[model samples]
Target: MKATREAYGEALLDLGRLSDQVVALDADLSKSTKTSLFAKEFPERFFDVGIAEQNMIGIAAGLSLAGFVPFASTFAIFASGRAWEQIRNTVAYPSLNVKVCASHAGITVGEDGASHQSVEDIGLMSIIPNMTVLVPSDPIETKSIINWAFKYKGPVYVRLGRMGVPDLLPKDYSFDTKPYIFKKGKKIVIFATGIMLWKCLEAIELLKAYDIEPTLVNIPCLKPFPEKEIIEIVREHDMVFTAEEHSIIGGLGSMVASTLSRSYPMKVSFIGINDKFGTSGKPNDLLSFYGLDAAGIRDKLLDNIK
Candidate 1:
């Protein structure tokens, strides 16, 4: 198991070696966000902007204007909630090639509590017109998405987490705009993002005892949502569920619901934090407390099915 943030760090280093134009900026969180690896390897290319997320974004914008691909790092809450305006106006507005790779997203931020956790980052980034939002499930996908973000020339928000997740994708896995189908089943279909995809997979095992098999899909790209692909996938299933380690309000659940409501108009049960703030607790314990664990997800699915 490995934290996606670790993959981001490793990928950032690879990017530095692959491209000299690649630069990094952080709001005093290089060690946690794993940008330290990049900083260590390419100190000259990295700029630590202290604890000022807004200023860091501004510098990233300036770097972009100067023809550099700057990847700004910080906690998701600060990156999305604190420096939102700077990101919106400075980076996203001009369609600059700035990568805002915020780590420690969702309730999984753990013992740090709600103040640090960012359940609304996806929505915050998604609402922006020129921003692209991504949530990678595991380390492999995280690396793939990071590589993809470096190549894609625009404002990109890649939400990463501190919790270590199991390796789900293969070593040769590549990032595609379409959602990944982890399992094939009938009737019920589940769409999950980030670490929640791993939880959903666990929930599927519990469902097997009841002879309930649901198709599972991993949605890594939140913005530029795979509408065409989702429409095609939903047509094959009867029931739909969207799970995320975020608020049910503006994350994967909301996006899937909106898409289906307009295109196919189907019901999508949401499995996520019900607009509540996180509290200090062990990461795994917090997941269970919020009914985001395998058993909780299974029960929720069964409740809807019954």
Candidate 2:
């Protein structure tokens, strides 16, 4: 098991080796965000902005303008909340090649309380024009997405969790904006993102005993959502359920619901944090408490179907 943030740190190191133009900036959270790994190897190229997220973003924007591919690392709350204006005006407005890869996003940032946990980072970043939002399911996919972000010239926000999760994708899996079909079933379709994908997979197994089969789709890309594929997939199922470690209001659930409501118009249920702040606790315990665990998901599905 590995955390996506770990993959991000390794990816940054690999990127640094591939291109000298690649630079990293952190808001005094290098150790937590794992950007310290990159800082160790490339001290000159790495800048620790010291808790000043807004200034860190401005520096990154300046680096981008100077023909450098700057990757800014920080906690999700500070990246999306504290430095949102700087990101919107400086980097995203100009559509610069600045990648803001935030770690410890969503309820998974357990024991940190609501202030540190970011449940609306995706929605906030997605609202900005030219800002690409991505959430990788596992470590392998995170590396792949980081590679893609480097190749794509624009502002990007990649959400990564703090907890170590089981790998769901194959070792050789490459990053693609399209949704990945983990399993094919007819009655219902479950769309999941981030760490919720693992829980959804476990829920599918438990569903087998109840003779309830559902298709599982892992949505790695949140913004520039795969609408065409989602519409096609929903056409084959009776209902759709979106699961994410975010608020149901404007995260993955809202994106999927909006797409289906416009084109498909099917019964869509959302499994996520329902307009509530996260509290301090063990990550696994928090997931279970909020009905985001495997058993919890299975029970919710059974209730909705029946």
Candidate 3:
């Protein structure tokens, strides 16, 4: 098992070696965000904007304007919540090449409590114009997405987790803006993102006893959403469920529901944190408390499909 943030650190190192213009900025969170790896190697190119998330974003925007691809890092809460205006105006509005890679997102942030956990970051980033939002399910996908973000122009927000997750993708996997199918089944479809994909995989095993097989889809890209593909797949299914370690209000659940409501119009239910903030606890316990674990998901599926 490996955390996606670790892969992000490794990817940043690779980018540093590949390009001179690839600069990293952190809000005095180099170690936590793993930008320390890049700083250690390229001190001159790395900037630690001391406990100032907003200033880090503004500096990144300036770097982008100077023809440098700047990757800014910090906790999801501060990156999206604290520095929101700078990101929306300085980076996104101009369609600059700034990659805002926020770590420790969702309920899995653990022990840090409600104030640190950022279940709304995805929604915040997605709502902005010219911003691309991505949630990588595993370490491999995380690395691929980071590499892709560096190459793609404009503002991009890649949400990363703190907890370790089982590697689900192949070694040869490449990143793209499409949903990945992990299993094929009839009538029902379960769309999941981030660490929730692993939970859904676990739930699928429990569901097998009842012959309740659902087509499992991993949605790594949440913005500029895979709407056409989602509509096509939803049309083939009887029931739909979107799972995420985020709030049901404006995260993955909202995106999927909004898309289908306009095009396919299906009964879409969600398995995620409701209208509540995350509390301090073990990651697994927090997931269970929010009905985001394997068993909770299984129960939700069984209850909803009936």
TM-score to native of every candidate shown: 0.99, 0.99, 0.99
Question: For residues 1-306, could you state the per-residue lDDT of candidate 3 as single tens digits?
Answer: 988888999999999999999999998888988999999999999999999999999999999889999999999999999999999988899898999999999988899999999999988999999999999999999999999999998799999999999899888889898998878988899999999999999999999999999999999999889999998888889999999988898898999999988978878899988989889999999999999999999999999988
Instruction: Please give the lDDT score at residue 241 for candidate 2.
Output: 95
lDDT per residue for candidate 1 within 103-138, as digits (tens), equals 999999999999999999999999999999999999
Off by over 4 Å in 2: none
Q: Model 2, 40: alpha-carbon shift in Å?
A: 0.3
For all candidates in order, the CA lDDT equals 0.95, 0.93, 0.93
lDDT of 2 by residue, 166-212 (tens): 87899899888999998888789999999999999999999999999
Clashing pairs in 2: none
Poorest 10 consecutive residues by lDDT, candidate 2: 260-269
Q: Which 10 residues in a row give candidate 1 its minimum summed lDDT?
A: 169-178
